[model samples]
Target: MAGNSDPLTPRAKLAVTAGKAVAAASRAAGRGSGSVIGGRVALKLDPDLLARLAQNLDVVLVSATNGKTTTTRLIAEALRAAGPVVSNALGANMPAGITSALAGGSDAKYGVIEVDEKYLAGVARDTDPKCIALLNLSRDQLDRAAETRMLAENWREGLAGSKAVIVANADDPLVVWAASSSPNVIWVAAGQMWKDDAWSCPACGGVMQRPGDDWFCGECGFRRPTPTWALSGDHVLDPHGSAWPIHLQLPGRANKANAASSAAVAAVFGVPPQVALERMYQVQAVAGRYDVVQFQGRDLRLLLAKNPAGWLETFSLIDPPPTPVILSVNARGADGTDTSWLWDVDYTRLTGHPIFVIGDRKLDLAVRLEVANQHFQVCENLDQAVQMCPPGRIEVIANYTAFQDLRRRVGN
Candidate 1:
């Protein structure tokens, strides 16, 4: 059973006071996850209390290595377009964040949350979402989430015997086959040919061979058939120019993929493709990922590379300028403890390394940049890195955790 004491009750005034104090402290500390972080600690200490608070809400659990935040936002937007939506908009994908989002919203028609892959099972078990949007599985957060295969297996075991409406990525042979046996599966396929990244089969651990946009594992005899929702050429307009004339504010192949997936989910909820398309076309750019900003008379493109796959996608879209570059890499405990995934990033794509490498671990990034055979200026201190960057023009590439840090350090 869940906790019985009313958080807002006069008898529980002390708890409410404590929650407010923690919230104030968090704000003073300049951390978004302040009160929510403290709440998570308290909730974990009393599991029943957490369960009681989440009594009758319908949850929409969205889990994926990449695009979780974007998709979650899109879903929430679509639902809001349909009616009303409640969600954690600040990239708080953990249990505590989810709990905080749902704590006092008793009338929420839709509780959409973007969940981290590692904690999906626990969240699902606790909330029992009515619909689960399982985005494509990729190599992300290797240090904490373990290998991709391990996370997939955990998802398989976690969702087993459940009756949740499973929305799986059909283009990803891995996601499609994993949900094959599920009662209700909506498989969404990727439409772009240039957007080919589904390289292997999730089942039987076999290499997949792509035959005309469809993948078939020769050894395991597993292949993804035509998708229920497919976004192909022409339909997927370029960021700059489009045959259909889609003015997508977001850049990169990954953003396009995020758009496609979100549109598919919107359609599943009965939003017409044309209407969803319009909603997407007019949507604002995702705040951090490939979010272009103006700084000191030069166009600053901030690309957040959280994982190896994300980095690869960013590299594909980036056309590095002749000017020197500023690269920031830092892994504080809050950002992410694991940095081993750096080895997986295709750093070799950064062929012509720029002049500056900046972050807490400047030497580590400098070593990664050394492979390009280019000279680099290392600034271990972030403040120094900003001072070291050429004043006239600079391009910045930051990983997941470092994006905020760069923005703070550069006053952007």
Candidate 2:
């Protein structure tokens, strides 16, 4: 993604200045990082502030139902091997926060935008990124966002004429279909662990024919594209069949999948896979995700998992059996105000653990766990939940707001 470095108009400059001032005030007041509010204020003053601020910066947007923040962070870090990068790493994938981030880092050479799935098209049009990483998309925030297929169709339609090189996930049928509209694409076999959303074809209402790893729509002739890059266990194979092992401080296969795709996107900016991954390996924690903190006499590893697809991936990263896990869920506006996705997650996998439930929608989670025949304890808050767990190495999985609450409580 790189836009012109032309100076902003008098009004745009004033709007940017006002937004930055408010953002600084917000930080000083401890009202949380002022990205969203400041951006809102700026856009209120000048609706085109995002496009104005995006000037002169090469942009690369990373969008997906899950891993938006982490992938943006990873892609930013990887791109750092080439030049300075400004990114919205706090899960603020919307226009406001992104505009604020671009305004904040106006001097940077590149921008890594973490766009919400629903807002991808507009953001792509505004930023006109040099490259975009289309990670896997699944049902998320169903109460607010469009259906999975609709969102994919939106991407296909929205990015129809963009010259941006799409680094798409080959393993995800929805992503493959969406990226197909783009003339330039670098396919990466970034694994899709949760496949329920891709059983039906988006190109046409038809069953996807799958034999082994290959997926094809029998009715519409839509199929999985051959990836130029593929993940083989912990290693990533490039277009030349050269294997580059990905080593990350971040835990789980999901992070490995992120790193693999990120390397490909970074390569679009002239950073080699080995160099990009080396920079990526330096990323210890994204925001507060995968961060281990000692709270209430226990070493808690905070894992953010908002939907069923996310929970499935998070479950694979958690400590097994008797390790004891804390699961928190919130139905706040940001959390989609829908807890039905809990039913889709296989909570039976957590059956052997001492599960502690917390947050505004703890009861919803408790009910789902009960239906899965997994016993759990309901706690009023994180403190009570942590107190119920045994000391040392506990894993905590929370939705958006709940995860942020944990970070705030831990003073991160």
lDDT of each: 0.65, 0.88
Q: Report the lDDT tens digits of candidate 2 across residue range 299-392.
A: 8899999888999999998887899899989999988987788889999888789999998988888888889999899999988888888766
Per-residue lDDT over 104-123 for candidate 1, one digit per residue giving the tens place of the 0 to 100 score: 45556667788888888888
Looking at candidate 1, the ten consecutive residues that score lowest on lDDT are 237-246
TM-scores for candidates 1 onward, in order: 0.82, 0.97
User: After superposition, which runs of candidate 2 have C-alpha atoms over 4 Å from their true positions?
Assistant: 1-5
Residue 92 miss distance in model 1 (angstroms)? 1.3
Show the colliding residue pairs in model 2: 1-58, 1-59, 1-129, 1-130, 2-57, 2-58, 3-56, 4-56
